[model samples]
Target chain A: MTPDERGEDSAIDVPDALAALLGADTVWTEPPDIADELVARIEQEARLQGDDQPRPAAAGRPRPWRRWAMAGAAAAAVIVGIALVVNSADDDDREPAGVEFAIVGTELAPDASGTGVVQVRPAGFAIIIEIQGLDPAVPGTFYQGWVRSDDGDLVAVGTFHAREDNGPIALWSGVDLDDYPTLTVTTQQIGAGTGSSGEQVLVARFDGS
Target chain B: MTARDEMAARFAAADPDAIRDLYVQYSGPVTTVAASILRDPQLAQDAVQQTFLNAWRGAHSFDPSRDIAPWLYAIARRAAIDIHRAEQRRRTEGGHDLDVAVTPLAFDRTWEAWEVRRALGELPDDEREIVRLAHFEGRTHSEIAALTGIALGTVKSRSHRAHKRLAHALRHLVDTENVS
Candidate 1:
C-alpha cells in the first residue's frame, strides 16, 4: 500500500529520507585525542582557578642604623664577588632580562587567577607561575602552560601538578618568548599527548601596553 | 530534574565532567556542522573546541527548561562561521586560494541537516533501524522487512511513526528557514 493509504496516524519515515540525503559519514569524526586535549585544557584552567589565593608579602624587620651599615657592607661585598665571577665568565652566557605578566580571571572564571613571569637567559628559558585559589586537579589530570603566538599557533610550554608545599611552579620553555607573548595555563588529562587543551584557565596577554 | 536539566545545572556550576559529557554527546554533530562550513578537519575541530568552551563560559545564559541540543548547535554553528571568516580573511591577505564560499542559505542547510540527524538519534531502535535501512541502505520497505524479518505492515507503520515525529520536532527549524 502507498504510505498515505496506511492511515492518517501512520508514522512518517523521516529517517529514510534523511539518511538518503545526509549519509552516515555526514557525522563528523573526531581524532582520538581531541576530547582528551580539550578536557585537559579545561582541567588545567580549573586547577589554576582553585589555586588562586592572595599570598602575603614578606616583611623584613627594621634594624638599627649600625646593624644596617654592617648589612650593607656585607651585601656590597657579595655583589662585588658576583660581578667579578660574571666578568670572568663568557659574555655569551649572560642572562636575558625577565618579563612579567599579570594574569587575571576571565569572566567565566572570576575567582581563577595567577601571576606569570618569563625569565629568558642565553642558555635557557624559564616561566614561573604563582597561582592562588585554584582547585586541585581531578584524578588523572594535570595543569599545563601554553604559549600562543600572534598567528594563533599554540605550543605547550610545560605541565605541572598543584602541590600543597609549592608556592609557585617554574617551568622551562624551550622557545623564546619574544614571538609568543601570550601565556595561558590549561588543565590536561595525563595521556592527552602534546597540544594546548584550549581550556585557558588563566591568560596573560602582553600587548606592549 | 531531567537529564538535560541536570546537565544544564552542572554546566552552570562549571562542572568539568558535565562539559565532558556534553562533549561526548554533541561533538560529532557539532563537528559536522563546523566541517561543512570550514571545509577543513583541523579548523573544524578547533571550532568544536571553541563551541564547547563558549558554552561552558556562557552556561548561565542557558535556561534549564529548554532543549540543550539546539542551544549547543547554535553555538557550534556560530563558532564554525567565526573560524570560516578568519580563514577567509587570512587567505585574502596571503593571496591564497579563496574558493571557500559560504552564505546564509548554506548555513541554514547545515543547521537543518544537524537537526534532522539529532532527531533521528532520538527515535526508537526499531523505527530508527527501519529508517536507516530504507534511507541509508537505499532498500525498499519490502527489502527492509525481509532483511529484518519484521512484517511488512509493522515496518511501514514504524517508518511512518518515525517520520511524523521528526517532522513535528523539526517544524520550528523548517518554519524559521522558510521565514528567513
Candidate 2:
C-alpha cells in the first residue's frame, strides 16, 4: 500500500498533500538581501520608539542561540540565504520579481529566441522582453507583449518593433506572475482594435519561478 | 533556562541582534508556513519580514516560559493572511477581484511541509542532492548517477542514508499531536 504500511519509515507516513509538497522542487523564494532590510527596519523602529536598551553584538559563531528542540537538526546548519523568486502579479506593488523566461517564437517565427527579465516595481510589472530575429514594427503594425493568466486573462506589458539593431524592449505589466505566468507576443495592426490580433509572432510560458 | 527560553527572553526584551539571531534560525520554516498560505513567494517573504517586526513590537507580552516557535508562527500566519487580503483588495482596485477566498491549508499540512523542508535543509549536501534527484526529480539510480556524476552504488547507499536521516529527523511530525 503506502510507504508506512509497507513498514518502511513512520516519517514516510505523510499524507498525500504533504508527500507531494515534500517532493516539489520549490523552496519558498525569499527576496534577495531581505536580512539587511529586516535588520534596518528593526533598528529604525527601535529608534523611533526611543529604544535605548543595550543590544547584543552580532555573533559569528555557529551556535550563538538555541532553537526549539523540534528544529534542532534544521537550524543547526547555520543557513542564511534562500533562493530568490520574484512574483509581481499586482504589486509590480513593491519588491522585485527577477525570474527569467526564455521566449521562443511560434510557427510564425521559427528562428526567434530571447528572454523576458521581469521586475516588480511600484509602477507595474516591468517585463524587459527581447526576441532576436524579428522585424521592426512597421508603420501600420506593431508588436505587443502580454502576460496571460491561467484563466485566460491577458495584460499587455508593452509593445515594440524590433528594428535591425533595436535592443530589448521593456514592457509594463499590471498583474502578478503567480496568477499570470504565460507570455505571448502578437503582431498588432495599427487599427485592429485593442485585442490581440492573433498573428502570433512569439510566445514564452514561465515554466518555473 | 534552556537556550530556546533564553532566546525567547531576549526576544521579549526586543534585542535587535537577538531577533536577528532568531530570524537566522527560524526564517526558513517560518517562510515555509507563510508560503503555504500566501503562495506568492515575494508576498510570503513580506509576511515573514512583517512577522519578525510584529514579534518585536509585541515582545513585551511574550512568556519566556513558553516556546517562541508557536508565538512566532501565530504572528507569521496573521501577517500572511493580512498580505493575502491586501493582494485581494489590490486586485479589486484593479477590477480583477475574484469572488472566492483562497482556502488555508490544514495546520498539520503546513506543519508537515515545514518539517520536511527543514529536514531537507539539514541533510548533507551530497545526500540532499541524491534525495533531490531521486524524489524531487524522479530520477532513477543510473539516471541520478549520470546526472550527478556520482557512482550508482554510492548513489544507492547515499539514498539509503538520506532516507534514514530524514526518517529520524522527521519523527516528530508524526509523533506530535500538540502542534497547532
Candidate 3:
C-alpha cells in the first residue's frame, strides 16, 4: 500500500513542511570561524591522545576482514559499557518519583550550575544529579557530589567527569537525604579519599519541603 | 578518486587536514540540527564541536566505501539531543520561562526534521530552489514557473523528481536505523 493509503502523512510531500520546520533560510548559515575553531580543538584532542600512547605501526596492517572484526569487537565493548549504565538506571528497585533541587554556582565556580533530585520510597532514597557549564575534569581529577548535614558532617554521594562540550554529566546515588540538609559539588583529585576536597563549585540547600 | 573517496581515505588515516575539510562541509547543517533541538545558537555551537570531535575520534571506524554525510549527520543529531537534554535540565532548574501551551517536538520527529534538511541540502541548485519555492515560499508549481520564468511543465517535473529523491533518501535513513 502507498504511504497515503497507510495514513502516514509524513510520507506525503514532506519537503514543504520539512522546509518550514528547518527554517531553510537561516538554518544553513553558520559563522565562518566555527570550522577553524572545531578543527583546532580536534587537533588538540588528537595530540593529547597521541601524547599518552604511541601510535600503532603503519606497517603490519591486517586483512580487511580482520580489521572489520577488530572494529566490531571495539564497538561491542562500547555498547556493553553504555548498556551497563542504562540497565543500572532502569533498576526496578528504585522509586519512580523524586524531589528536585536547583544546584546553582558557588562563588568559586561562578559559571558552574546543576540540579540534584532525591527520590524517597519505602526502600530508600535515590539521588540523581545533572551538572553542566563546568570545566572538563583534568586527568587524575574528578567532581564529587557531597551532602552535608545541619551539624557539618559531609557525605560523599557520587563522582562524575565533565567534558569540554558542556554536555551534562548525570551522577546517581542511593544515599538517604533525611539527615543531609545541604548539597555541595566539589572538585577532587583522584585518590583524595572520601573526605571533602574543600573546593566546592556548586551548593544548594534542601529545606525538606 | 572522487573528493569524498579521498576524504574517506584521509579520515581513516587520521590526517588532520581531512578533519578541517569535514568540518567545513558539515558544520553548518550540524549547527542547524543542534539549534533546532536546543533553540539556542551558543549551545548549538557546542553540539557542533562535539559532533566533529566524535567524528574525528571515530574516523577509523567509518567505512570509506560508504557515504560519510549520513554518518556525520547521525552524530550531529545525537549531539543535538544531548544538548537538548542538558538545556531542559538547566531551564527546569533555573525556573526559566517555559511556555506550557506549546507542545514540544518529539525526539524522533526532531531527527526526521534534521534528516530532511540534510537531504534537501544535497539537491542541485535548481532543484533546491524549486523545492524551496514550493515549500518555503508556499508557491504552487505554476507560481514557481511564473516566478522563475521557467515553463509550467518543467517546474512540475522538477518538483516531482525532487520529492521522489527526498522520499527515497529518507526511506534509506529509516532502513539504516532499523538495521542498526
Candidate 4:
C-alpha cells in the first residue's frame, strides 16, 4: 500500500513490517538492552576467539576524510577504532547489502566545503571528516586541498567551493599513499581580502604502515 | 520523549554528549534486535555499539522529520544480522551447524510485513527508502514528500510498486508459511 492508502497513522507496526526486510528472526530481538553482562561475556568470548590474532591497525585511529567535522575538537578516533573491528567481522554474520565501490587512492576528494575522506590503499587506510556543519565559503572564495611535506612544501590535491548547484561534495577518489602524510585544505579568498579566513580545514590523514 | 526533543537534546551537533545520550536511548531497542538474531548477548551489545557509531557519523544523513527509532533499529538489525549470518557461514563452510537451514518467522497476522521488508531491500536505494518512509513509518504522502525532499507523486507510485513487488516475491512463502 502507498502512503496515501495507509493514511496518516503513526501506529504502523514498523518492526513487524521490517521483519521481512531483516528476515523472520529479527523482530524478537527488540526490547531490553541485550544486558551489560551479556555484552561483557561476548567481549570476553570475542577476545578469547581472536586472542592470538593481531589487528590490522591500532584501535581508534580515524580514517582520512572523516576529520572535517573534528575541526571543532571531537575525538572521533575511538569511534573509528570500534568501526574497524566491526567491519572486519561483518561478512561473517549478515547478508551482503548496500552500494559497493572501490577506490584507487586518487578518487578521494574533499566535499563541497572541501572536506572528505582520503583513500590510502597501500597503507590499508581510509578516513572521513564530518562536513555537514561547516559554513560555506562565499563567492570569489574557494577551498583548496594540499599535501604538505615535513619540509614545509605544499602540493595541490584539488580545489572546491560551497555552492547550491552542487550537492554536498565528497572526495570519493583514492590517492597515492606517499604523496600526503600531512593533508590540509585552506580557504583562499581569491578577491581582495585581508589575512587568512583562518578557515583552512585539515580533513584527515593516513596511518603509516 | 518527543522525536524533536530526542533530536535536540541527544543529537544537536553529533558531539560526544549527543552521541552518548543517543547510545543510551536506543541501546535497549538495538540490543533486543541484535540479541534476537545472534542468540548471543555479547555479540548483540557489540552490534548495538556499532549501530550507534554508525549513526554518529551518518546522523547528518538522517531526515529529522522521520521517526529515529526505526531508522536506528534498521541499522542495528542489519549489523546484528550481518554478524549472525557471517558466523553461520563460517560454521557451515568449515563444516558445522548444518542443522539450521532457514530463519524462524517472527509473527502471525501478516507475512506481508516481512515480504514488504524483503522487497524493499531488493529495490534500488532511492525507491527502497521512499517505500520504507511511506509504508513502514506511516508517514503521509505529503510528509514523505517533504521529509525525503522528493516529489509527492513519486512517493505514491513507488510505494505502490514496492508493495506489489513484495506480494509477488512472497506469494510462495505466504502459501506455505503459517501466516494468519
Candidate 5:
C-alpha cells in the first residue's frame, strides 16, 4: 500500500505525543547515579575487545559520501545473476502470512522510502518492496537489493531497474528473516565488481515487531 | 571553550571522569531512545550501557567542535539494532514468529520525545519537579503549589523558567515537531 493508502494520521501531534511519553506510565530507564558499575561494565567490555583506545577505522563506519541512518556492513562483493528472481505478482503464489516492515532511505537517497514484505517459502524467502520517491536507474545501472544476515553475510535477493515508475518489486532470498534481518537496495553498474556497490539507496531492518 | 566542548575534548581523550559524567548526563534519554525501538526495558538498559561503551571505543573520532548528541544517538541506535537482530535470531532458533517491527512514524515520534526527555533531565532539580507536576502530573500552578507546598506564584515562575530552558534546549526540534 502507498503512503496515501496507509492514511498516515494515526500518529498523534508531536507535543501531545511527547507529553504522553513523559507521563508516569512511560518507562524511561534512570541510570544508576553511581558510575562505578557503568565504568566497570565498559572497562570489562573494552578488555574483551582489547581496550584499544582510538580504535582502528571500522569497515562498517559511515561512508565517506554519507552516513547510513543505521550502522551496517560495507559492500564486500556484489552478488548478481542466477539467484535473483524477478516475478510479476500476478503469476506466483504468495504465502498468506508474511512479515512486513517500513523501508527507509539511507543518506544516498534521502527522499526515498518504501515497505518490504517477506514470505517464507519452501525454497527460500520471497520478498517484495514497494518503493517511493526514488529515481529510475539510468542506462548500464540497475538497482540490486540484498539481505544481510546477523553474522554479516550478504545474499543478493533480487534486482530491478525502476522505482515509482514500477509497482512493487519482488525479490527472493535463500535465507530467512531470522538470520538475515537487514534488506538493502543499492544501485550497481553492469560492469561493477561482484561485491555490492555499497552505494545504498534504501535499507530496512526486520529485527522484531 | 564551552563546557560541552570541553567535555567532548576530555571525552575524546578518554578521560574517565568525562566519560562517567557524559554517561550520567545522557543515559536516561539514551535508554529512552533504545526502548523506543527495542521496547524491552532490560534490553534497552543494555543498549544504553553498550552505547556508552561503543562511544568510548570511538571517542577519538569525535569532533569536539560539534554537539555530541548525534554521535551518541547513532551509537545508541546501532546498539539497539544489534540487540534487536540478535534477539530475532534467538527467537527463531527457539521457534517463534516475527514480532511487530517499529514503524517510521513511531521512530520519529519517539526520538522527539526522547530528546525532550533528555532536555528534561538537564533541568535543575527544583525546576524539573515543577515540570513534572505541571506536565506529567497534569497539575495546574495552584495545584502544584498546594501539592509541593511551593507558593503559587513561585510554582508558576519556576514552571515558566523550566519551559523556557526546555524550549531553548530543544530548538532543533521546533521545525520537526511542528510538522504533523
Candidate 6:
C-alpha cells in the first residue's frame, strides 16, 4: 500500500535527505568484512544441511542461520513477483511459519532411508530428514542429498549432515527440479571427491500435490 | 588472490582463518548494529558469531552476483530482534528485570548523531530499521536476512538500495563543511 513497499521511488527528497544525513559509509557498506560475513554464513548453512547430529552448543550460543536454496525455481509466486513478496512479509519473524520451499536436485546414498519432509512454497524450501536407526557417519564422510527428475537424473539441490533434533536440514542454494519426482540423500567423504560414493541413505517422493 | 579464486577458495575452505577473516571484517559494524537493536554488547557478540557461523555453513548458497553486506546485516537484525523477543518473553513470563541500558549519545547535540537520528526518523520504519542495523549496529545483509528470516537476496538488494537512498537524502548535510 505504501509507495516504498510498492518499490516505487517515493518523494525523492525524503530519501535524499535521509541519505545526506546518514553520509556514505553509514548507508552503503563497501567493507570487505561484510563480504566475509556473508561468505561465512552461507558456508555454515550449507554444512549444517549434511550434519546428522546436533552440534555441541558453543560457548556463545548463536542464533540459527537460514539459507534457502533453489527458492527462485521452487517458489514461482515469490520469485516471479518479488515485489509482492517484499510487500507481504515485511516482518521476517512474523511471516507465515509453515510455508514449504522447493528442492530442484539432490542425490541420496543408496542405503539411505527415512522419511524426509521438505517445506516447499513460494519463497523457498527447507529439508528435514529423519534417520531412523542409522549410525552417524565418521567425520571424513558425510551424507549428501540430491533432487532427481522422473527419468532418474541427479540434480545437486544441496548437501547436509544429519541432526539429532529431528529438525529438517535447510538448503542454502537453489536446486534445479524442473522434471523431478523426489529427493535423495547419500554418504560422501568430506575431501574424498564428489557425488554419493558411500551408499543411498533416504528418498522423499513428490507427487506434485 | 584472484577475485574468482578468492570466492572459490572461500567456498572450498571452511577453516578458522577463513572464519576469522569474516569476524575481523564485519564484526565491528555488526556489533554496532546489534547494539542498536539489542542494546547489549554480549547479545551483539552472540549475534556476530552466529552470523558468521551461518555464513560459513551457507557459503555455497550465496550468489556471487549480489553484495554480501546487506545479507549479513539482515541476519544481524533478526538475531537482535530475536534477543529482544526472548528478553521480552522472559520479562513477561517470570517478571524479570527489564532494565536493559540503551547507549546514550554523548553530546546530545552533536550534529552527527542528530543527523543520523533525523535521517532515521525520516525513513519508513522498515527502512529505518535496516539503516539502524547497517549504520548504528553494523550488520551485513546476510546477517540481516538470517536474523530477519527474509530472503538473503532481498535483504541485500533492499538494504543496499536503502543506503543509497539515505545517502542521497543526507548528502547535503555531509557535504557542508560545518557538519564534516
lDDT of each: 0.62, 0.64, 0.60, 0.46, 0.63, 0.48
Chain A TM-score, candidate 6?
A: 0.43
Task: Residues A64-98, candidate 3: write the lDDT tens digits.
Answer: 32232234323423322221111222233332323
What are the TM values for chain B, all candidates?
Answer: 0.76, 0.80, 0.72, 0.51, 0.84, 0.50
List of clashing residue pairs for candidate 3: none
Q: Assess candidate 3 and give its TM-score to the true structure.
A: 0.48
The positional error of residue A197 in candidate 2, measured at the CA in angstroms, is 36
TM-score of 5: 0.50
Docking class of 4: incorrect
Candidate closer to the true structure by TM-score (higher is better), 1 or 3: 1
Q: What's the CA error at residue A36 for candidate 1, in Å?
A: 3.0
Candidate 3: what's its TM-score on chain B?
0.72
Candidate 3 docking quality: incorrect, acceptable, medium or high: incorrect
lDDT of 2 at B116: 76
* Distance from true location, Cα of B62 in model 4, Å: 0.9
Q: Which stretches of candidate 2 lie over 4 Å from their true place?
A: A1-18, A25-32, A51-209, B1-6, B99-101, B104-108, B175-180
Model 4 DockQ (Cα-based): 0.11
* Tens-place lDDT digits, model 5, residues A1-209: 21112332122122444455555323335653325544644443333333222122345643221121111122211211222222223333332234456788889889998877654443455566788888877534668788898787888776666723759776766555666778989987654455799899998876432
Tens digits of per-residue lDDT for model 6, B45-81? 4455456666666666665456555566666566656
Show the colliding residue pairs in model 5: A77-A194, A77-A195, A77-A196, A78-A194, A78-A195, A78-A196, A209-B99, A209-B100, A209-B101
TM-score of model 2's chain A, to 2 decimals?
A: 0.52
Candidates 3 and 4, the one with greater DockQ: 3
Off by over 4 Å in 1: A1-33, A54-209, B63-67, B101-105, B142-157, B173-180
The better candidate by lDDT, 3 or 4, is: 3
**Tens digits of lDDT, candidate 2, B1-180:** 877678888888888767777887678778877777776655665577678878888989998788787777788778878877877876788798565346455544666666777787788989888777656665666777899888887877787788778767876764563233
